[model samples]
Target chain A: MTTTALKARKEFGKTLASDIAHRLRNEIVTCQLKPNESLKFDALRLSFGASFTTLREALTLLAAEGLVVAEEQRGYKVAPVTLEDLHDLTHARILIEVDLMRRSIEKGDDDWEIRVISSLHRLARIEERAPEDYASNTEWKAAHRQFHEALVSASGSPTLLAVRNSLFDRAERYRNLSAMFRPHPRDKAGEHRALMQAAIGRNADQACNLIASHIQTTSNNVAKYASGVISAG
Target chain B: MTTTALKARKEFGKTLASDIAHRLRNEIVTCQLKPNESLKFDALRLSFGASFTTLREALTLLAAEGLVVAEEQRGYKVAPVTLEDLHDLTHARILIEVDLMRRSIEKGDDDWEIRVISSLHRLARIEERAPEDYASNTEWKAAHRQFHEALVSASGSPTLLAVRNSLFDRAERYRNLSAMFRPHPRDKAGEHRALMQAAIGRNADQACNLIASHIQTTSNNVAKYASGVISAG
Candidate 1:
């Protein structure tokens, strides 16, 4: 009943759940598991090699994050991606990311602006290549994500950024789907540069418009491939 | 491989994990578990009286949904809500919901409009008073959610709708937080009426703006109280 005891009890409870959730999350987000893939318990148990208690602890955390789909009679499967999902996701992505960018443009200081510019520079230098057969190519993906993340990092709202990050992750699966098919567009670099320039110049309105269009551009491209896959099946 | 053999392999591979994920998702989203609460596995296992495999399946599914947060060292805990999170979440909510409303309006026919009107009416009739001494009132919450969901149900984009639902669940936690503070503004009824009218009238631009403002109005109110709490602490 004491205050200290109550605090300890609460902390202990939180610690366990969060730990399990973290491991499961990294596995899914990292694509250690494939999309729409079934997650078998015995397999998962052996994979983690942890006790049932600890593994359950982790899974409950993952369930809350929406990486897996829960079926009625069926068990969890990795969440699937479709072109329709991608389009809407991109729409929401542009809305949130562009909004964040605009906010960052308004609230961001010179240092924040510099950070955005630097992240862009890193992205510009990294060459985009196939994720497979071209092992070094993942650096490009990582850099590209960092650049986009940097633009909104100074938006001054953790919740917005967190949601933004989740949307980005969901989009990533779709992005991967399209990765092997199309050649990297030439204009992407130019598009990003314009976006950075607008933000740094504090043209919040134009920046928002550009970001929205930029987000839509990718969605339109991804939709074609996703639709084909969905339609074929 | 024979067709039957392949089919059997697929069937056998799918089990336990996703099944548990589905059940756990329902428990969390239906508010079976309180927000910011810890999910104790031992207790959950006993409650369901199922094996460890069954529980882990459910928890993993929830994690994918972003309803739970995974901590590195800690176990699974329900995602917490703060005033900052509410502010960001509400803004994102308005952005998505308003856009969905516009799409729904554009795609909706007479029946779609009727559904919205009916859902709002049902919500208006629901008793807002707590249902019992211990349990939160489910009827009002269900009605409230249905009204908003109905507005976007005809948006014709499953992906957008799914993301919208996820954000709504997170927002519910904040709503719960605000509920404990004091009486919310009483004019929510009027605002919903206006929103429904604008959508039915097919005033896409007006409906969009109205919804944006409508969502902001509530967010601002809730946030004001939440901020006060933070500052006091």
Candidate 2:
């Protein structure tokens, strides 16, 4: 084959591998794959209808993101969750998030402010439409993520934003698990509104403090539910 | 094969993959593998005497660590260094390290204190022996890492520590590059000694400020040298 043809084939292979990884990532985070379950290559090949090479590449990508664990002899497994890990994750998130928010408030322009307000409005609408509907929970979660991202979008440091994004994804997985096992009723909408207000008012200290408490409450709830789920299992 | 035998074989494969990853990580950070250089699998497989599968797994792990970039059709390449990225990295490190130091000071036990002193002593001795000996630079780098790790060992938060570790490794690469290109001399020993003294005195504010400045100075120097190197190349 000519060099151009070879290059094209390689590019296609990479895109396919990435697509597989993205699908698997979604499944793992949504708990469809279940934590700690070994990802047998043959089974994944059959399920995804991809070659071993493609599946292996996909798994490796997920492993890099900490969504999957590359077991020494056992191939890969969906990363397990625990109360301690959840607490630690939450703690780190609070630190990075609050710091980013403070920077965002200090440096964010009008565009950043508008995005935050719009995201909050969208999130509130989603929650109001179906706060407890499992069918629409995914939409609500997406909106929630957007709202949080918007609040800190003006940090202007890609490194901080990247760290915040990773932590947010990890927390999202636990949040999803929490909703699954224990459907607790809480004033999430009210809390987010207050967070938005504080951020918009340029009250960095108050906004950060509110975010800390906001994250802490969710973590406590998730931890309580996660433990119960583990014990029952 | 029986289940046990099959498991053993799988374990060996995983170990081989991990070993390859470790070897590549060292090379990338030390600039043995130049940045933006494509990691052609065929060549790597030949050089490492490993199969394509094993080599690919290794590259993916490095990619996950941000030391390597997995290109679409071109395969993997060592991540390129830029002054902007370096600055962002330093900023993130300052925030995390200082916060961690504050916590460490508040909670570090006597054992933690002893470890910090020991690490500092070892690092100081290494610097004094050969401040400019490129041959033993790796040893010096390891000592420097240990000293920093020891200072924050009492943070009591694994997540924060993990993030800090990743950022530290990234910065280490830039430092190595800076030394290779510029080879400037500085009072690194004095700075580290003062840092250790502040921590040992339980002066959180002073220690944190010192660390922030220490990191900033290195970053500034590295940036200046890195830009020159890049332009020269």
Candidate 3:
């Protein structure tokens, strides 16, 4: 093969690996793959219609992101959920997210303000829709992530943002798990609006306080429901 | 094979993969593997006496730790350093480390205090041996890491420590790079002593202030040297 042909093949392989990782990540986070369940290589390859190399690469990537755990000779398994993990994750998230919000308030420009507002609007609209509708729930989750991302977009620190993003994703898995077990009625809309108002008002102290409480409340709810589910199972 | 024999073989594979990852991580952080240089799998497999699968898994693990970067089409490469990265890293470190130190002071027991003093003693001894000796420098780095780790060991948050450890390793790479380009004389020993004093005194604010300044001074120096090294290269 010519150099160009080899390069194209390599590129295709990389893309294929990334695509498979994305799909697998979604499955794991949505609990479709189920937590703590062993992931058999041959089964995953057949299910994803991917080559062995591609599937292995995808799993390795997920393992790096903590969505999957690489076992010795046992192959990979979906990362398990526990209250301790959630507590640690929540504590770390509060630290990073609060700091990022403070920096964002100090450095965020008009664009950042607009992004926050737009995300808030979108999320509120989705919340008004059927809260139990799976599709709308997914949309709500995405909008929620967008709003949080916008809140920290102007932290002007890539490292902070990256750390915050990772913590956010981990916490998300627990949140999703909790949602499945117990659909509690809460005024999420009011809380988010308060958060938005503080952020836009450029009250770093208030914003940080709001965010901490917001995260802690969700964490408490998730912990309660997740424990119930685990104990019942 | 018997079940025990099969288990042993599986354990061996896991150990080999972990060993390779550890060795590669050291090389990357120490600049034995140059930053941004492509990690050719064939070359690495030949050098490490490992199979392609083992080597890939090792690389994937390092990529997760941010010690290596996985590029599309291209393969893994040592994560590169830039001024922007340094700034962001330092900022995040200050936020996390200071908060951790505060918690450590508030929550630390006598044992934690003993560990901090012990680590400081070891580091100070190492510093006195040879501040610039290449062979002893590695020992100094290890001791330094230990001292800092001890300072935050009482934070009581595993997630915080994990994030802090990753950031610490990345910063070490930059410090190593700066040491190569420019060796400035600073009373690092005294700074560390003051830091230790504050911590033992249970003065959270003072300890945090000392650490923040200490980190900032090193950051500024490293930034100055790193920019010159990059530009010259």
Candidate 4:
């Protein structure tokens, strides 16, 4: 084979591995694949229809993101969820995300305001359209992520935004896994509306407090609802 | 071959890839491998005595840490050092690292105080013994890292610490590559001593301010010294 062809083939292999990883990442983050579930080579090979090398590469990527746990010679498993982890993640997010939101409120221009409102509108639509399965609804998840991202879109720091993103994704898993049905769904629309109102009004203090409360409320629900699945300790 | 032997061989392959990556990281971070320099696979294979696959894996790991940049179909280059990057990294580090330091000052216990003193002592020793070559001195590098790490060791949040560590390493590159000769050397030992004093005094405000100033001072030195190598824009 020509050198160019060999390089192309190698690139193709990498892209394929990454593609498989993306699919697995989506499944794992949304709880389509349960936490602590064994990801045996045989079973995953059947499911992903990729070679062991490709599958292993994909798993390694997920492991780096803390979604999958690599067991030296044994293989991989979905990382287990526990309330303790949720509390720590929630606490960190509050510190970083609230600071980001405050900066966004202080510095956000008209374009930033527009994005906040647009994302909020989209999120509200998904909540109304897919209220029943909103927890596991992929569309809702994306819209929800967009709304929060837009809130901090003008944080003016890529580094802080990256940190916020990682914490958000880790928190997403716990939210999806727990509380399939909330006796009271915690007035998410009202909370989001208040958040938007405070942000656009340039009330940094209110926005920060509202976000801190919003994050903790969800965390509380996850703790109570996921008691069966996650240990409190 | 037995199944066990095959598994062992696979593990060994991974270990070799990671070992090469660690060696490359130390060299790159210490500026032995200059910034924006090409990382041709052939040269790396000859130098590291590793196969193409192992070297590629090693490069990929460094790429993830922003130590290496991958150019499609052209292989890789060490990530560039720029004044703009230094400014942004410095700003972000000030926000996160200062907050972490404040938390440590507020919450750090007796043991944390001991670590603070010990790390400061080590850092001072390196600055005195290796003053001439401290910038590229690997021992000084490790000592410097430990001192900063110890400052935020009681931040009570792993997430924030991880963010601080990444920003620290990225900034380390700029400082090493750009300021091999600081006209004033910035009195690093004095600054570190002040940070330790404020921290141990349980004075969060002073400690946070001191850290912020300490970071900006180094950035100022890098900016002026590296004017020749980096475009100001």
Candidate 5:
């Protein structure tokens, strides 16, 4: 191939790989792909209409995000969810995310507040259903992520946000598992509204407290339910 | 190729890629590769005796670790070191590593204590010279890293340790920069000995404080010296 065509083709490959990674990430996070499931390339290639190289690249991205596990001399598997994993993720989030939220409250401008209000509205409008029902509800999932991210949008530290985001994405599987076994519907809207008020009101302590509880509650529910279904150690 | 030959070739490629990745990681972290310097494929291929495919695979791995930045169609560069990045990494280490050290102290058994003492001894035996000298001193670097990791090896949470490890590594580049511009050599050994005493003594609060200060001191020194060197934004 000519240099120009080769460069263009390489760019196309990068975009295609990223697109496939996003698709696979959503599936894995929502439990549609399921935990500890082997991700055979042939099946994934057929499903995504991607080449082997593209599929491998996509899996590499997911592996970096901790959503997929790459084994030496073996293929990839969806990362397993365990009670210990959930607790670790929860503790990291409480420490990092709460600090981010406090910083956001201290540093945020009017635009950040506006984003918090609007994202919350978007999420509040979506129906918060059970895990099985919401598994395919990408819109609600996106809105929920936006709302949480918007709260800390002005933390002004890209590294902190990236760390917070990875922990958030890794914990998502457990949230689905938690919802799957929840005996009663959580008043997520109410909780989010409280968090939003505290954040915009500049009550950093209260905002941090609410987010910690919000994280801890999901963690508790997941451990209570998933302990029996997955590895305890 | 036969199926077995193909499988063997694939396994060989994986190992070669990982080896290249490690080599590149050490160079980038130690700043031998230099921050924001272009990593052209042809030069890297010649230098590492790697094929284009193998080099790309290695770059992908380094990208996952935040040591390499891949530009679409253009190739890669060593990840940049900015004051903001240093602060973000240092803040992360303070919160996460201190927490890990605290937990390791609480949960660590006799082996953890022995490892900490031995690693400290190993580190102290080596010369903690200037950055330019220590840049080539992989032994001292390895011992230093082992000493810190050993202090938190029993945090009982793989996820937490993984996060801590990443933060620690990303901060390494800045530590080298800090040492490069130091007006006087720091008593890192003394600080580390104190930290070890606090950790093995089960004084979580003291250990955490020592680590936070050690991390903060490096961060402040780097900011003071390198403020005029790199990107401010």
Candidate 6:
């Protein structure tokens, strides 16, 4: 094979795998593929317009991010979203993220605070409604994700942020799915404002405590909502 | 495929994937693949004597646990080991683990204390050599991992335990790779004994501090050793 041909083929494979990866990540994160739904290679090949190898490569990336589960023979599935998982995920999130916020408050500069404030502004403006159901709006989902990511981006520890992001991604599916069954009335905007106020003021203890309570409140709310459905079913 | 034929095929796939998963996991944890080694698919398939489907499935499982990284076109690679990563991983471990030890002290049963003591006794029995050349000793590695796991198994949080196990698996490769560097005089067994004593005596603060220092000391030693080689390279 010519060098040019080999290089072209490599580029093609790279683009194909990444394209497939982006589509699969969005599908799992947004629940286009329902929880515990099996992913078949043959069907995915036709749908994704890729070969078995390309599709598996994409799935491997998703699996690394905890957005998908791969079973030996059963094939890949959207990772099961459970109340217990939500509770644990949130607890771990608080454990890592609150510390991150504390560190960020200690080390974050004006630019970091600016980023946090901007993300909060965006979140406050977003409409929070059911993501599905035609007339429903949940631009809040995207805004909420941005706000949380911004909170830790200043943590300055790449591994901490990376693990935090993974936990957040996994928690998102459960959060959206259970949102329809349960609506939170408490002022999320207020919580964000207080969190920002504390962090901007460089009050690490208050910021840490607020973040912990904020996470705990969401965990309790989601767990109650999800368990209610299981019993009802 | 016919129904019976389909069922048989699935069984075969399941066994093959699972077997590869088990072997691959051990190979990784034991540092057989080495840190940052390229995992070309064809080579892995040949090494494992498995089909592409089976190998992909196994790699997916490892990827989920953060033991390996998947590249878009290049294929999988053993996750890299670095001092920065070790520092972050160690800090995260200490945070979760110290909290866990405290919880175990507060909530642990007599059996829990006994198990901790037993693990300490076993760990104390193992000879501490220069890990530089001892990285390949299978028996020593197994005993070391078991000792650490047994300490926190009484924490009563499966999620926490699972995350801890995952971090430890990733750190082992760095530990092995860094082992080939200079030796530092560290109290290899005394630290474990002190931690165990404090825990059994219900000295939460002492136990927590000991564990934290214990982990950081090793991190510092490994960092000192790796920096020279890493910079030279």
Which candidate number maximizes TM-score? Answer: 5
**Looking at model 4, how many pairs of residues clash?**
0
Interface root-mean-square deviation, candidate 3:
2.3
Error of 2 at B77 (Å): 2.2
Indicate whether candidate 3 or candidate 5 has the larger TM-score: 5
Q: Is the docking of candidate 5 incorrect, acceptable, medium or high quality?
A: acceptable
Off by over 4 Å in 5: A1-14, A128-136, A181-184, B1-14, B128-136, B180-184
Each candidate's DockQ: 0.30, 0.57, 0.54, 0.30, 0.46, 0.36
**Clashing residue pairs for model 2:** A73-B11
TM-score of each: 0.73, 0.87, 0.87, 0.86, 0.89, 0.80
Clashing pairs in 6: none
lDDT of 2 by residue, B40-139 (tens): 8888987777898778878877776778888776778988888777877899999999989999999999999999999999988887788676323778
Residue A43's lDDT within candidate 5 is 96
Winner by TM-score between candidate 6 and candidate 2:
2
**DockQ computed for model 1 against the true two-chain complex using alpha carbons:** 0.30
Instruction: State the TM-score of candidate 1 restricted to chain B.
Output: 0.77
lDDT (Cα, tens digit) per residue for candidate 6, span A108-215: 888898889998887765633332332124467677778877777787776667778878877766666666677554456778889889989888899899999988
Q: What TM-score does model 6 score on chain A? A: 0.83
Interface Cα root-mean-square deviation for all models: 5.5, 2.2, 2.3, 3.3, 2.2, 3.4
Give the per-residue lDDT digits (tens) of candidate 6, residues B114-202.
78877666655555443443345666677778777777777766556777787777777666656767564454667777887888888
| CAPRI level of candidate 6 | acceptable
Q: Model 6 — TM-score against the truth?
A: 0.80
Q: Rate the local accuracy (lDDT) of all candidates.
A: 0.69, 0.83, 0.83, 0.81, 0.81, 0.73
lDDT of 4 by residue, B97-141 (tens): 887898888889999999999999988887888677576677877
Which 10 residues in a row give candidate 1 chain A its minimum summed lDDT?
Answer: A127-136
lDDT of model 1 at position A42: 79
Q: Write the per-residue lDDT of candidate 3 for residues A1-233, one digit (tens) a residue.
A: 56795455334245777777878888888888888989998889778777776788788788766788887667889988877778778888998899999999999899999999999999888876766543327777789899989998998987778777777777888888887777564567888899889989999999999999999998998888778654332
